[model samples]
Target: MFDTTRRRTLEWLGIGGAASIAGCASQAPTAEDTGASTSTAQSTSTPKPTDTDRVAADPADVPDPISRSESTHHDITLTTEEVVAEIEAGVTFSYMTFDGQVPGPMIRVRQGDTVSLTLENPPESQMGHNVDFHAVYGTGGGAVATTAAPGEANGMEFQARYPGAYIYHCAVTNLDYHISSGMFGMIVVELPEGLPPVDKEFYLGQHEIYTDKGVGESGHHGFSFENMANEQPTYVVFNGEKYPFTPDRYGTLSVEQGERVRVFLVDGGPNYSSNFHPIGNVWSKGYRDGSLEPPIEKHLQTAKVPPGSCFVGEMETPVPERIKLVDHALSRVARRGLLAEIDVAGEERPEIFDPNPDTAGSEDEEGSAY
Candidate 1:
């Protein structure tokens, strides 16, 4: 079933003809480009492991992705769990997820709201896990205050002092490995006045998974530390699987033509950066790094969404078409599994786009000649 659905969607999107339509291109900054040193050594400063006692929380129970507190004070709880799931038709990956899902859950709060968070590592987990919220303004971005080993729980309180979307992920000794294994999420701190109203909103996360087996090898796969260190990934995917946002699979994101849509994207890539682009559409307003301040870029064709960062973009669909959302890195789409679709259903406007062009029958020789 999965293979059939994926192949049909790929054919419909013309994957063989063109990966994506031409658009404004932007380069994402890498460690070398930004003059930042990449750390390869594991931490040895922490104390040796010892049996610690704490209440174990159920990893399955977590807040809904769209759930939010109406009051000024909010309490959030996250539990770490390790589970094996299929990445594609016959490819399996052992994912370390927060609340048992890749990209964790979307946390929404007001700018001035006080948030109390709890990090729980279930006993079944083999390693320790912690969370560092980019929206926090404290030590280690609240990682130090909430690090918990398996069978333990830790809590901390912080104020959402600023308004923006932020990425949160494990900050353990092997931070990169943990994040690449699907331990990350986003927190949106809305401004007091809130954002502009839109007809629809969607949340997605992009991450690369490195495994010993090659792409589409079709068997159980294991994590490859060597590939991770070298920044080579077997799969670069949205949500958790290949071609999830297709009509036959999980279902494409649907919106009516002429409706305004917003997309909140968090890149959990422990490695490669995401050149986020919506083929066949343009971002009327793009808030880089989830910033809502002034100087929002207008009519952007693509924007760079770095690892551990968020991006917010809005679009106005003028015609009925299937918009293909991608990283804009052609190789990733052609080789690795990275693709999504947004289906805009409504009456087509031939004035804007003619479905059938009469090239052979047209009398204008100059314009019709191809």
Candidate 2:
């Protein structure tokens, strides 16, 4: 089925590829200078098949929590590269990434630890790049210290003085363009003892993509500065693509019942905020804005995480069900394509939730309620 609602949203905003988009065919500096490859296709609402790669970082690819008791030194390296990847089955976009993934990789360290970070811009890169870490106490958060032009490398050392989760992103010129294109990630400076243990943990990033093309248009999409300025994102997504963690896409994030799960969410929004909520569950303990301080809030239904911020929340999966992670903005979920899912596999908790109490244990040939 076609997405009529999204189409209406475009119409209401007068966003059209040929008419309203202010920066039609205007690519980011890197994509433009490097002559990024794009398929030639007729603009249609229907998706066109693309051979491009995917940029969404696997939600399960989070670094293990710190296990050390004392402060230590760590070495980190981040490479800046531009990749042409698929936002969906048929649509492609050039993404600026820190190690070829959206939101890059999670950097984990103990509080008071010293970190030596290297930022590398390959010779083939068409633009300069640097990182501004929120956890750093230094000016520009090491942005000025690690600015690297193409074919260059820069390094800086900083101490993780505070204990909390923080965001790190490209802080080069036109950072909004770069961040919206996928150059952001999270860093966790944990207390000396580290965070409480949990059965599982997942890492995710939320950001918006502004393109001249609307939702389902085919062909390679270009970044739109005008749309970004207007704060009218063509897509608001988790990881890199719309509904990347949903069952219909890359498959739902799996968790067993009776387990406690931790989610580290980094909001990389160049604009807009995330009203993070987990359907079918609540944040049993939420560290507001990624704060690691004790006395975390309890039973938070939705947490409002703004741009360039982070949120760490825990959930208890006591029953088998599909819990949807969404931006409670609702319209973003319905139109802008932002969603994730957690599939809890275990016995049902009929005592808690029952959809068909009348049928009770009765089952049909399919082993489902009749």
Candidate 3:
């Protein structure tokens, strides 16, 4: 919902109209040049947005913080370097990765475990890369342990100190170089066993892709000296790949009716924000960083998830519907890159659309821009 003051300012500045027109004109490239004179100037960049969407885990998801730990060990290798991933079809660019996926791997550990990780940040730029787990209360949780040399692993030995969903991103803040480059991820601590088993669980995080390769200090290539001073990013994505990148045929979470699904969503924007929208399903319970509030029972069109946080969402699928997992920062939906899909395949019911009717004007923005 926009206020009158904001609407008046946009009208005076012609933001909505100009954005609409410019969006259309940007697609004039093909069409055999219909005799119309074209401008060579690229449209001015939209100022980077500070406000987007954010979410929190439910506290009820946390059994008891001081509870005993079952004590287990897991080896997670944190590596950053240029690797090629097909973000867009037929277009594989040098992208920084952790074992190869953009948002890194699905890191899950029970409440009581000693997690050790070997961070192999390949020598991309001269700058170093390191891991900082927000769960650690001391040594700034590894911020002091950042290393610049590639193949030079930044290793750490730490126990699960928190019970909720905490963030794990680069703490190196020189020009926000670490995050802007691609060195970031998430950390979720689960309750000691005995809770009901999840039918299926998945991992996802949000960030911007600045270069042709990807976003975050975790990219495969170094920023051009000319671009080092520039901050306008080109694409935003979920789990490191852009939308349509997860085209219907490629990336998707396939589910069926009557299935209970749990999504472990961790937001690592370290910048913008995110609005998690699961089209067609109303998440009844929201675990704010493992802290469960009374579940948000209403049909939610958009849910906010701020940076540096995580949450768990439980949804019971009653019928089939095409679900869009988007960063309701709608601009991010069409352009910024954080768009993914879920195809609910199965039979339908007459009651499916009544509770969450498709509103009058929820059309997503249209664009072919990266």
Winner by TM-score:
2
TM-score of each: 0.79, 0.85, 0.66
TM-score ranking of the models: 2, 1, 3
Model 1: CA > 4 A from native: 1-71, 360-370
Pick by TM-score: 2 or 3, better one: 2
Q: Considering every candidate listed, which one attains the maximal lDDT?
A: 2
The per-model lDDT (C-alpha) reads 0.73, 0.81, 0.52
What is the C-alpha lDDT profile of model 3 across 1-370, one tens digit per residue? 1122323322332234323221122332221222111221211222222111111111113222223446679787766554444444333333444444545554666666887776675544333445567666656575544332443555667787556667776553332334544556666666665234555555667765455333322323322312323545556666655564255424566777777776666676645666777766666566755443344334544567776677667777777866677776677776555666676777767665543356644356463332
RMSD of 3: 15.8
* CA-only RMSD, every prediction: 14.6, 10.3, 15.8
- What order do you get sorting by lDDT, best first? 2, 1, 3
Instruction: Give one clash count per candidate, in the order shown.
Output: 0, 0, 39
Error of 1 at 81 (Å): 1.6
List candidate 2 segments past 4 Å from native.
1-52, 359-370
- The C-alpha stretches of model 3 lying farther than 4 A from their native spots are 1-69, 84-86, 90-94, 122-127, 146-148, 173-175, 212-232, 290-301, 354-370
Looking at candidate 3, what is the lDDT of residue 335?
A: 58
lDDT of 1 at 12: 33
